[model samples]
Target: MHPPDAPGTEPCDWSWETAADPDEVHALLTACDAHQATASGTPAPRRRPETTRWLVESGSVHLLRHTTGPAGMFTLTARPPSGTDESVFPPAEHPLYLSRLAVAPAWLAGGALVGLRCVRQAVETAAGLGGDTLRAQVNPDLRDTCSLLDLLGFTPCGPASADETGRRHAHLHRPLTAPAADRRGD
Candidate 1:
């Protein structure tokens, strides 16, 4: 379920489902990669066909849509993506991993609201699933993402580590408690 819009943004609808269709997932990720490439001045990496299939098969993929259309997406899973170093995360009873988060370029202009909402959703979902902690490995270059994770109470688990792709990511985590509404007094 999509949460309500923040105080000053357009009315948007956030919806999610377990991704069953690879085509949809591929398209969204492609758009996000192109946007990131433009912003970062690096060419977008070509993704393998198996990557989309892995994303769909490996975890629960959630797609966020606004009244305008698909706005963002994320994945939650018990296992980290293939190259992630497991030692970076802090100990927890049950950890749910958050990965592959992306917001369309159009929605990014509205600030980090979309990304914030996605993290909040992950928190709620993780807690509901009996997860004691929510963990994520994010590219350090994405300043907006790093900032949002920090603002929402996620702390760095350890030093940044480079994946096989040679990109450095800072591992972050937050312990789960009550739902976001209760904790924030919403």
Candidate 2:
């Protein structure tokens, strides 16, 4: 069974489950695509179902859904790298990789609290998965991405990757509370 939805005064429930297939992954991505389009002034990319299906068969990708609201579903998914450690936390001790973190807009205005809670939850999930630091390549194309991250305790540093492509993305990171040295990248 999944955990309860965020504590909203109005009260709605949210569930979390492992997305077992790529088709399910696509549904989440497609929603993310829609969200990116709505949040940004650009059109969401058309995700080819074939590629999405291929990812599912690859065996490292998984999805989580948060259901219980006008708009429900996980809004977050991670495609773990190949040869990961399922025996351990995070299943794959992927030191660094990409996580398709997304939140629907409908849940924004009426549910900022819920959304923020999920962000924190994501951080906790990453930590529980034995992650040293949670890294996200925030698309700078969306100006507010950095600000939102900043509010959530993430900071931007190290080599940035914006100039190579029209879409700039800075590697923003939030570290765990273990060895303080790990947080300080030299």
Candidate 3:
């Protein structure tokens, strides 16, 4: 998917795209490295030089680039997990899980609002592909993220049920039926 073609400060109009037929979905996860760094204060997930190849080969990645303009283009793609056959999600209800979401520093001008919009688009796109729910996990300690999740219509699955990751994450869910406009103030 290409980003917003218009030149502006708004989040590079988010959409899905793929190039070179890398067999897997590709996204600009490295940009989010800053977010991860601030939270963890460490860069554990190093970007391999050949990551694009790996991303293309093992996942159904979708890329979001800032339109067909400019040179500092940033793209974000989500890929399915490996061995994703155990039915973690219902085929007809949750066909695709939002494995990753990232944006370049320059494109985060709209703040969390842009993120919610991206989620809405992805959910709608997934629904069109026969999905009902979009599931994702966020670190619980990241106070900044909870409000975003709440704004996006995600309720915590409670502390007990989501303690698998050192009790640091809360399972979040979003349904396609919720109007994208109503996703806020939920």
Candidate 4:
């Protein structure tokens, strides 16, 4: 991971681990929920403890830490194409799915730099894992996240759809093998 480009900021470090402490994950999620609620004026549903554990055990979690402390976290899991619906994830073919991406409210208030770095890391990791594409299902209401995905070259693959709980998600995908120029040189 690269250090913050802003002068006078502490250098940041990134760690990739297969398992993350559930409590830490929960804390981060709570912080994220609070931030979302404040920004959107609608409180996000708190994730269950079992869901948090599933995230830790389901894939590799990447954590970003600044000299101050944990700045952000994200998980990447490879999903087989077999069971995935073609409408949502066309040409899935073992794509790397990015999930649970959260930048602490403190970091988020500063700028998109932290979020950008995290998504860039996901792209790099997907390429390294021989993944053809990186995919994510984002809550449409989270405009910032959808915008970030757009800035990083992700394109909508399908229309927004509501889940069982009535939460809506927009499917997006970015081809990992695209040329640098095609990715806007990011």
| Weakest lDDT window of 10 consecutive positions for candidate 1 | 1-10
**Judged by TM-score, which candidate is best?**
4
User: What are the runs in model 2 whose C-alpha is more than 4 Å off?
Assistant: 1-12, 42-51, 54-98, 109-111, 163-165, 180-186
Residues 1-186, candidate 4: write the lDDT tens digits.
233566665442445445468777778867987897678765476578777777677657777666665777787887522223456766756588887788888778777387888898889888999998898877778898889899999999878876666666677889888665777976
Most lDDT-accurate candidate: 1
| True-structure RMSD for candidate 1 | 5.5
TM-score of 1: 0.80
- Report the CA-based lDDT of candidate 3 relative to the real structure: 0.49
Model 3 earns a TM-score of 0.57
Indicate whether candidate 1 or candidate 4 has the larger lDDT: 1
**Please, what are the lDDT tens digits per residue for candidate 1 over residues 1-186?**
233356544453456667777677778878887887677654565666687787788658777776666777888898877667778777787888988887777777655467777788888888899998998887777777788899998998778866556656788889896556888999
Instruction: Kindly provide the TM-score of model 2 when superposed on the true structure, using C-alpha atoms.
Output: 0.61
Candidate numbers, best lDDT first, in rank order: 1, 4, 2, 3
- The parts of candidate 3 lying over 4 Å away from their true place are 1-15, 19-27, 39-59, 67-95, 109-113, 160-167, 177-186
- Prediction RMSDs, each to the true structure: 5.5, 7.5, 7.4, 5.0
The C-alpha lDDT values of all candidates are 0.76, 0.53, 0.49, 0.74
Clashing pairs in 1: none
Better of 3 and 4 by TM-score: 4
Q: TM-scores, in order shown?
A: 0.80, 0.61, 0.57, 0.80
Clashes of 4: 0
**What's the distance in Å from true for residue 92, model 4?**
3.3
